[model samples]
Target: MSMDVTFLGTGSAYPSPCRGASAVVFRTEGDCWLFDCGEGTQTQFMKSPLKAGRITKIFITHLHGDHMFGLPGFLCTVSLQCGSNPTKQCVDIYGPVGLRDFVQRSLDISHSQLVFQYRVHELLPSHDQCPEGEFKDFLSLRRENSVDPEDQGRTIYENLEEGSYELVADEQFTVKAFKLFHRVPSFGFVIEERGRPGKLNMEKIKELGIQPGPICGKLKLGATVILDNGQKVSPCDVLGDPIPGRKVCILGDCSGIVAVGGAKLCYDADILIHEATLDDSQMDKAIERGHSTPKMAAEFSNLCRAKKLILTHFSQRYKPQELVTDGDEDITVLKTQAQSCVLFGQDVTLAEDFMTINIPIKKNN
Candidate 1:
């Protein structure tokens, strides 16, 4: 099994000649999923190996324009491509409450018709304090207008009711979502690949006089097989220890490390992709703007015991090898501070547009 992550864009709020915007693509099991779709993301996709049609799902962090502007155009392109084919593709979008409205309004204004099917699922925070207040307000408005409340819109997808913790689970992997602290409602995602079964020892099987046949299939399935000689063979007799899978944590724009569910979501992550919009010198500015600096991101990685950290979402001010003031002292810094803060063997990296990271599964010793 192969798992890869491609960084489509790495800039925050603005686009530069070097960086586009915020977008990340995870490809596994022959399917692709997008984290955020910023402006010019479709153009960035054209430069990478990913195809727009392969995107089965998109998880938007927030309703911010920079993180979601390219969604409408990308969806339109996917719809156009699928129209020529007989099979119609479907892409499900998951985001905050206002996402559905934004997409609907964009499509309506542009007069864009989609041939493919798409569904929007509104993500509700698990620990919502006043959920009933919003519902009551909606009901009150509907009653004042003398219209059927049900006629307003269909409740197609509700992540809260369906258990928002586990976003996706299958035989191959599982994806989980956690709330993050941001100016607006935002979320972080964790994708964990399921551990693979131990490799079969072909030499041991041959030594046991077991021929390669259908019985081997049963053994692979952990079923005890009775050979032609009436010998019972267990899978453990010819299988090595199981190999551990990889864990990846992708965080949205966050001001600080959220205590609630933050540690759990990122605990022991193999790769933690975090937003580092500012350097250590601009810590106060980062907090004011609801973003994180590189030092803070490194500390968060240390707190979560993450094995590796990939920092992204850089501000446009810093260029490669430009001198900047860090407190009273002046220091030359690169476009991104790709410095390593080793904590229990953890390393840090600076993400660049179109950079691909291939995550490999580790075998048991």
Candidate 2:
């Protein structure tokens, strides 16, 4: 059940020849989730092996152009390729308020028609208000809006108890979103895979002279099996430790770490994908623009005890070598040498366009 995250675009604010803006694709067995369709995201996708038409879901962090300017164009292109079979493929979009208005106006002004349907779910924080928008006009739009109630555009109010709220979930995984402090309303997403049963220890079974047959299957179901010689074997006696699910936290741009309930969003994350828009020397400028420095991102990663920190949304001022040279780890971790002094550990990564990271599932087997 391993998932792959492909960095479609990784630069901040604007698109450059070398780097585009923020967009990432999280792909699993049956789902392809696109996070932040920045300017030229479709162009970036052309360079990767993934197909734009396969994007099942799109999540926008904020209304910033760098994060969602390409949504209209990308959606149009995907609609064209998805063909007339509405059931064959449809897109789901998630974001904050005003996203529906933005996408609606953009598509309307262009007079673009789609063969398939696309749904948008806006995440509304407790402090925010979901304006009475087209949710009531869905029946009037005819083919313009999704006919299926489940696939129609809607608002999702925040229901976090302790900084944790699920966006969507199934038997395999759950996607959670939390508030992120920024100049505008922003949010972060966490993809937590469900845990699995421990592997059956065949070596131990053989040690007890248990033959491979229906008994092994019964043991897998956690049943106490009796041998022909009147021996009882519990599933726990031979199974390995249960494999805890993996967690990947993907954040939007943040001026600084959130004080309330931020850790619950990123605690013990296997990979924390955060923005490092500038270096520590540019802390003031970064804060002014509602962005983060490498050190600031490091602090969050450290506070969350993340296993690997993947830094993206780099500032255009730096060259590829300046941030991270070839074969050099880039996502730096800072630890205090004294009350104010700090040391850097380049063990994580600084993402670039088209960077693919496969998060392998550690199976009990």
Candidate 3:
């Protein structure tokens, strides 16, 4: 299976005519996951190649206007298009505190109730506590009040109950979240596929005198059973060991937080999407604004040991043509050479809005 990541908006806090806000679509076969709905997101969707109805889950990074302003509009659009069919369908929404109230009030005042049902999971009172073991070494150094109250740090899955830690949705892939450092509680999500068992050898099945029926199903289901003739069959006898899945992480804004396990959260990601809102020249400005410069992004990528890094959430000051028109020698280099250098070492790419990146999957022997 292949995962496709398409950026809907790539601009930073300010709205540029060229880009909208922060939004990306993570797609696999029948599932479409949306990350952040900035202003004009619905309009952006209309222009994109994906179908709006395919979005089953929506994740909000923070309460920034640029990150969440488009939610109501998108919800309204869903109401207009979904109608009665969607009324039975529930769209699971995950966001920081006050998100449910904000969206609820917007719909209540506008009288634009969605035709589809939506269950909003608010990360209230924060859950950014680090996991036990090595993470404790990092969190011990952070100030007590430095954490965001609404930051649901590292939300792995959304359960029906608020404090439930059980796996809420079990599919072929697992989606895990971790906390990041920003003005508000922001989260980074890592989508990892579950290991898959080897395929059935059809020739061997026939050779074993097993008919092509539910018996084959038993093998694939990893079950051992006795045949009518008292024959024994086991999954291991037929299939090879399970293969590990690909890992990809998408993070919102942050300068790396020690409290939420910091760089460790992004470790070993096949593809890491770190926000690069500023250039190397503005490192001080980036720190003041609670954002990361491109060089910082590179440093974090290297520290996390990610296979590939993708820098996004660009400031409006940088234009697409400027990325090439001015060249690396230009006075106003939109992207820092340091950022490109890090990417070159790890095969990272600077992603653009509306671009779909396909991660190459290993072929099983």
User: What TM-score would you give candidate 3 relative to the actual structure?
Assistant: 0.80
- Candidates ranked, most accurate by TM-score first: 1, 2, 3
Model 2: lDDT of residue 91: 73
Candidate 3 whole-model C-alpha lDDT, 0 to 1: 0.71
lDDT by residue for model 3 (98-173), tens: 6766786788799886777676665432444322221212222222355453332332343323222222246676
Q: Comparing candidate 1 with candidate 2, which one achieves the higher TM-score?
A: 1
Candidates in order have lDDT scores of 0.75, 0.77, 0.71
Task: Report the C-alpha lDDT of model 1 over 64-91, residue by residue, as the tens digit.
Answer: 7889999999888878877887376567
Per-model TM-score versus the true fold:
0.83, 0.81, 0.80
Query: Which regions in candidate 2 have their CA more than 4 angstroms from the true location?
Result: 84-87, 126-149, 203-234, 322-346, 363-365
**Regions of model 3 farther than 4 Å from truth:** 84-88, 125-168, 206-209, 226-233, 259-265, 322-345
Clashing pairs in 2: none
List candidate 1 stretches off by more than 4 Å.
126-164, 226-232, 322-340
Better of 1 and 2 by lDDT: 2
Residue 67 C-alpha lDDT in model 2: 96
Best by TM-score: 1
